[model samples]
Target: FGKNFLITTHYASLPWLDSLLQEAQEKSAEEHLMSRGIAFLLYTFLDTLVDSYFPVLDDIDEIIDDLEDVTVNSTSNDVQVRIFRIKRSLAQMRRVISPQVEVVNALVARTGKFIPAKMNPYFADVHDHLIRAFEVLDSYRDLMGGMLDVYLTTVSNRLNAVMKQLTIIATVFMPITFITGVFGQNFGHLPQVEHDNGYLFWIVLAFMGLITALQLWYFKKRGWL
Candidate 1:
């Protein structure tokens, strides 16, 4: 069974290696180089891989900066939504980056004939960078998470403040509403309905009540009540 599996794997690997060999041969033929020039060929392959990943790293860095901007400047719900979208994009970027880290690690782990010994350190450096990138991403994720929490708390606090202001306004108007409602009643038996000083008395009482409430509110605001 192992033999059969090995045979199948060998066959599968042949097409891929054949393609690599064909490309190497074409490039070598263009430069009129021999198969013994494996180091140059390996260098070309590794360089191409490194170059491809550099752009990915640059993109991730750009995304991190954008996310940082969103986290900093976000105020309204719309901005929060944008921040969340940035986070989603960062998450997707990490998904792509995480596998690339493995690819680098795999390259570093291999003692393959294709990989030159001197190039291993360079690959290891790249792998280290991948690790650092992941760490930075995690830190940024935590920062953004904290930022989101702060934003939510700020919004809630603002809402609470608004509610308190509205409540205080309602409380301030309660006595005025009560006085108006009582005076507006068309009851014929009311004593104030027939007295000349009755309107003035009610007006003075309403003013006094309003003044008392205002003084109380002012004292409360200043923490001096």
Candidate 2:
């Protein structure tokens, strides 16, 4: 008997992957499969599939790791959008692998035809690898959820800081506004109104200074400044 390999995938853009597959195909020795040709061929095929996932998983892990820095440092909304896009890509990969797993299981169950009794273990190994791949994807999904939470928290903190600063500015101006308003009013019979009083200016300056000092102290004490 002879073994023929046919690989069908949606990954048309990766030239290196195509080259790797082509090289493997050309370098594969039929002499190595002289005895258990069918079984080992299936093993080779499934092993390739299983091994391919590790590098992809590694790349995904690296990107996920970088997301923490991106969440903290990036000011552009594109980072969030890129995260969603990566998630969608991961979902697509998961979708593809799930069906492949089902297919492998079905092949394993219908063991009479293409896959013989001797090859069951090899197919089971494929199924195990597929399961591991899915588990990794599950972990990545959880990680994506965590990254989103971190992003939201960082954004909320920045917003709160801005609001706190604005509030402090408004608070500082409040007493100064009160002083200006009192001095601006036309109370003709008031005690300090008759003289061109520098004392009135002194009083206003003192009130403004006292208010500013008090606010600074309160803000410092509250650690909100």
Candidate 3:
């Protein structure tokens, strides 16, 4: 383009540019872009590139929606992994695209040999698309952050629930444990140890059962169960 001739090369296939090139080639003969010069073609190329990002953003939107629905019930590590991965992807996209937004805006503002004054509206349109992309990306970043918070909160709540259950079990066994400890003593004067008919054993068992039932009933009444 600097030598008044458009030279192009690609080490990797760019599907977006490929389609754009195809269309441009088909229009070259009829549209006579050669008469308007390479500036027009450059604008079209950049415009196509900018337009490709929308489809990707749309797909990200769908993924975010799905994640939000699953985030409430999902406790798997996969959800966290996906959230981080998408966040990194969005960050990379923002880094790469942000400068391009400015560049397009600059192109609209500055008229040069390659960028004509008459094409400001075209470049401005590209700028608008870039701004829209930025808005979507920023919103997705916020959503990803929110999803991460929700996942952590869910995990914390589950942990608290487990701890509560364990604590309740311990509480229910506390008096029973004390009763057994008292009977387990080696002292001969311990109640029920001097019994010859083994009636004391049944009494101790009944007492323990009674304590357990009472504790459970209290817990149920308090809505702790």
Candidate 4:
């Protein structure tokens, strides 16, 4: 197994793992990691695996930025979908990275003949890289949680705005609805009952228009719109 590299995984659909291996191979070509011995090669592979997390996390950070923008300007259902999607992605990353902490620690703890003394320090360095990956993953998880909270709050505020708008519209029309209802009555003793198309009707219409304009102006000045 000295010169042979075995690539085995149950997940054939994992393009990320393949990509990491490919990238590590490219870097190794430039730096010649093969001369660093077997244990060093192991460290290099693990370090590459850990380093791949950073670019993925960067992409996730970009998504969080987009989600935050959506939270402020819009409350579409897609925001909720994206929030959950980010959380799930973070969870998956943790699943992959967390156990590697233990794996790297075990590798550093080994004192067998297979692991040369000179490579112990290299394994320790890889262990540190795994620790940093775990820390960053946790940070990303917390960030995703905070974004979820902001998204929920934004949705709630949007709902309240819609309700408030409906309330305002109903309140502005209440008096006009009452006046019209009364004037539409079939009673014989009503004052404006016979004046269907006369001065009283025009006066009521002007009064309603004035009240509507005043309400709209008041709402605008209050910055409710």
> Model 4 clash pairs?
none
RMSD of each: 7.2, 3.2, 1.9, 4.4
TM-score of each: 0.65, 0.83, 0.92, 0.75
Provide the overall lDDT of each model, using Cα atoms, as 2-decimal numbers: 0.64, 0.78, 0.86, 0.77
Give the higher-lDDT candidate: 2 or 3.
Answer: 3
What TM-score does candidate 3 get on C-alpha atoms? 0.92
Query: What is the lDDT, from 0 to 100, of the residue 86 in candidate 2?
Result: 78
Q: Which stretches of candidate 2 lie over 4 Å from their true place?
A: 1-39, 73-76, 186-191
Better of 3 and 4 by lDDT: 3
Misplaced by over 4 Å in model 3 are 6-11
Q: Compared with the true structure, what per-residue lDDT tens digits does model 3 show for residues 2-119?
A: 4255666768999998887676678756686555777777777778888899999999999998988888997899989999999999999999799999888888889887777899
Number of residue pairs clashing in candidate 4, backbone atoms closer than 3 angstroms, sequence gap of 3 or more or interchain: 0
lDDT of 3 at 175: 90
lDDT of 2 at 168: 94
Clashing pairs in 1: none
By TM-score, the best candidate is 3
RMSD of 2: 3.2
User: Looking at model 2, which ten-residue stretch has the lowest summed lDDT?
Assistant: 1-10
- Which residue pairs of candidate 3 clash? none
